[model samples]
Target: MTSALAELSEALANVELTVPAAPARFLRLEFLEDAPEEAAAADVWSVTLDVSGLDAVPAAGDTVGLLCPNAADEVAAALDLLGAESRADRPCRLSLLPGTTKKAARVPPHLPEHASLRHLLTHCVDLRAVPKKPLLQALRDDAPLVMVAAGTGLAPLAGFLEERRARGQRAPAWLVFGCRHPELDFLLRDELEAALRDGFLSRLDTVFSRTGDRQRYVQHVLAEEQARLARWLVDEGAVMYVCGDAKGMAVAVLDEVVQTVAKAKEVPVSEAKKLVQQMQKDGQYRLDVWS
Candidate 1:
C-alpha cells in the first residue's frame, strides 16, 4: 500500500502551494484529533485533504474515484516495482493496477461541492458509497419504523425521511434520539421539528442524559414507552433501527429493548430473544451502528 505521507510529498512536488481548478476545486485540509484515551499526554492528528475535480459531480447515492497527482505517482511507482509498466510507449492507466491507491469518494447532499468541512456536521452527513443498500431497502417497505440515533447518527435517518417525502409516501416513522444535552448536542433538531410539523414523523422522542442529575437515555424512554413499542412491534410489524455508540449505548439500548419486549408481551425471555433475533434476520430490525 502507498503511504499517505509519501503521497503528501508527491502532491507537494506537483502542485503549487495553492492552485485553482474550475471543475475540480481544492477543499480545505482537516486534522482529525485522536480520542482522549489514545492521546493521554500527546496528540494524534489525522489529516484529510479534500478536492472536487471530476468530469461530473457525484450525487447523494453515487460513489466516484478520487484521483490526484500524488495517488497517480504512487500507482506508477508500484507498477514500475511490479514491472507491470515495462512495455514501451504503453499508456499507463492509474486505475488498472490491482493495488493502486485512490481514495473512496462519496457525494454529500448537504455539503457544498467545492468546500470541505473536516469532522464537522456537513462532512459527517455526506453520503458515501458504502454498504447501506440492505439497510435502506429494509426501511423502504411500508412498515412502522422506529429510528434511534445519537449525535450525528441522525444524518442518515434524516436522509431516509427525505427519500420518503420525495416519493410521496406517508410512512409511519418515529424517532428516539439521545444526546448529551437537548440544546447543546442536538444535531438536527430544527429539521426534525419541521418534519414533525409537516406530519412526516408520527412521533419524536428526545433524551438528554447529561441534563438531569440522574442520567436518562433513550433506553429509559423506550422502557417508559414499552407498551406503545410492543404494540407497534406486534400489530404493525414495526422495524427498529439503532445507530451510534456501538460499545456502550447501542448495547445498553438493545438489552433494554429485549427486556421491554419480554415484559410488555408477558412472554418468556427466551421467546422474546427469539422474536428479536428473527426480526433482525428478517431485516425488520436494522442497525447502522458505529463508534
Candidate 2:
C-alpha cells in the first residue's frame, strides 16, 4: 500500500473496546438467527443482546468480541499458588489480524477477583464506522450500491441493509455473496431474500462452491455479473464494498472490479487499475478483509 493510502485507511479506521473505569456488567445474549454461508466456514449468527447495563450499546455493524475465560480459569485454579498481590489487575490485548488498515485494543481488567464467565466477555467496537460505513452512508441519499461479501464477512453488510430497510430507504443495491454451502451457511438468506422481495435490495446472487465438483467463489459470481456491475459503476456511479478473506477472495474480487471498470470504459488495464486505486483513495471502494 502507498503511504497516502495507508494514511487514509488509518484516518478512517478505529477500534474501541469497553473500558475498565467501571466494572463490566453482564448482559444477556439472545440467539436470533444463524446464516451459514459456508458449511466448512464459520457460521455468521444474528444475535441480540440485552445491553441494558452497558454504558452504551453497540450500534449496527459494531462488533462484540467475547473474550474466552480459559485464561481466567487457569488464573483462578492457581490463585492459591500465586498470592493476592501477584493477582494485580492485568490487561489483556484483543488483537485483530494485523494490516495497514487495522488496529487492536486492550481488553480492560474490568471485573472483580471472582469474575464469572459472563464478566470475561468483552465488547470490541469499531467507533469510527462499521466496515460497510460507506455503503450505509450512501443509503442516506439513496445512492446505488454494490456489496460483495463471502462467508462470515456478510455480517456488517447484512446489518447495514437491515438498518436501511427499517428506515424506509429505497437505495437500489446488489449483493453477491459466495460461500461453501448455501443450505448449511447462507447467513441472512431469509432477510436478504425478503429485502429483494420488498424492493429494498435490487438484486441478490449467491455461489456455493463445495456443492459442486468445481470450486467457485464470489469473484466468479462477480465475473458472471460483470455487465450489471459495469453499468452500476460506470453508468449509475455506484460505490462498491467488499468484505471477506483478504488473501484470496478480496484480492480476486478487487481484480474483477477493476477489470469491470476497464471493460466498461474501454481503457487500458493499467488505467483501470489506477481508477480502482483512485476509488479507494476517494473512499468509494471500501474493503474490510482479514486473513
TM-score of each: 0.57, 0.63
Residue 160's lDDT within candidate 1 is 69
Q: Tell me the tens digit of each residue's lDDT in model 2 across 6-101.
A: 898787787555676966878888774554443266635568778899887555556555544344445544443445424334543333344545
What is residue 280's positional error in candidate 2, in angstroms?
Answer: 1.0
Least well predicted 10-residue stretch by lDDT in candidate 2:
121-130
Cα misplacement distance, residue 60 of candidate 2 (Å): 2.9
Stretches of candidate 1 off by over 4 Å are 1-135
Winning model by lDDT = 2
Over the full model, what C-alpha lDDT does candidate 1 score relative to the true structure? 0.67
Which residue pairs clash within candidate 2? 35-187, 36-185, 36-186, 37-185, 37-186
CA lDDT of every candidate: 0.67, 0.73
Residues 149-212 of candidate 1 have per-residue lDDT tens digits of 8776676677767666666657789999987766556776788898888877889999976665
Instruction: Estimate the TM-score for candidate 2.
Output: 0.63
Which whole-number lDDT from 0 to 100 does residue 2 have in model 1? Answer: 62
